[model samples]
Target: MDPVTCAGLRFAYGASPVVCEVDLTVRESEMFALLGTNGAGKTTVMELVLGHRRPSGGTVRLFGRDPFRDRRRLASEVGVVLQDSGCALDLTVAETIRLWLRLYRRGEVARAAAGLLADVDLEHRAALRVRQLSGGERRRLDLAVALCGRPRLLLLDEPTSGLDPQARERTWDLLRDRRREGTTIVFTTHYLEEAEQTADRIAIMDRGRVALTGPVDLAASFRRIIEERIG
Candidate 1:
């Protein structure tokens, strides 16, 4: 089964609609990217897929099950790193990871914590309080914590938004490694270059619906759209 599926999905806040009749499917082990300008409803779609928001209409499925209805059963299989993950600012980086491990799994908590820290290149910052970390560092921490349970599907929203080029590449490499290990990833980004380089498939959203969806080779079309939007 595909890791993600959305059919006729709809959402809104109050009377205004944000997403309308969107249909999408993400294949297993593929790196998929959702691209759009701010307020284009990409974030809404992310929330729907992660079961954080109920769809106003239609269905969202992860592995053939409604994500919201079967969240607990699906929790271990999915991980998410949002732009703001609501992480505790008071805890040390190491403490935060340990805490997540305590909440999510049973054994090898320490070992897993170590591995996650290494994966995000934050081993040296382990003792720093989360509040002390920079935005990029905190982003890395978010990724580390999201990976605590070793999920098969990873979801990210504007993950590289504020990262420097070096940090951005590192994040990409980490994701590439995970993809090599057969993990499916779905992410949203404004950085067209990054998406063009990393994504196997791309979906461009406009006015709350998918305007275009295709393989990465659609770069020429992508450039034209971006130019049109700019001009």
Candidate 2:
């Protein structure tokens, strides 16, 4: 089954329609990128897929089950990194990882904590409290927390938003490793170049709908599509 499937998905905040008739499918083990301008509904679509919001119309299924209804049962199989970490500010980095491992019911907290910290290059900051870390460090900690369960699918919104160039490259490398290990990743980003380089398929959103979707090669025509659909 596909990791994510949405058919005619729709959502609105009262009378303001945010997601309108979005149809998207993310294949298992594929790295799919959602590209769009601000307020184009990319993040809302992610929320719907993650079961954080119920769509007003159409269906959203993850692995053949309704995501919103089955979210608790499916939590073990999915990892997520969103814009806000929401981690306890007073918790040390290692403590935060340990908490996630415990919540996920993962054993060997010490080993797992070390490994997760290493995965995001956060081992050096293990003793620092969440509030003491810089923005990028906090983001890496969020990534570490997201990876606690060895998930089959990862949903990331602007996964590399605050990192330096080197850090961003490392993050992508880590994601590539996850993909090699059969993890499906679906992410939204404003970074077109990141999409072009890392995504196997790309969907460009405009005005709460997908304006174009094709292989990464479609990036060559991206500017034209944006102009045509968004202008």
Candidates' TM-scores?
0.96, 0.97
Local distance difference test, candidate 2: 0.91
lDDT of the candidates, in the order given: 0.89, 0.91
The sequence of per-residue lDDT tens digits that candidate 1 reaches over residues 1-231 is: 999999999999999899988899999999999988888899999999999899999999999989888999998899889878678999999999999888787478888888889988999999999999999999999998888878999999988877888998999999999999999999998767778899999888887888888888885466888646522
lDDT of 1 at 51: 91
lDDT of 2 by residue, 81-135 (tens): 9868889999999999999999999999999999989989999999999999999
Predicted structure 2, TM vs. truth? 0.97
* Model 2 spans with C-alpha error above 4 angstroms: 227-231
How high is the lDDT of residue 131 in model 2? 99
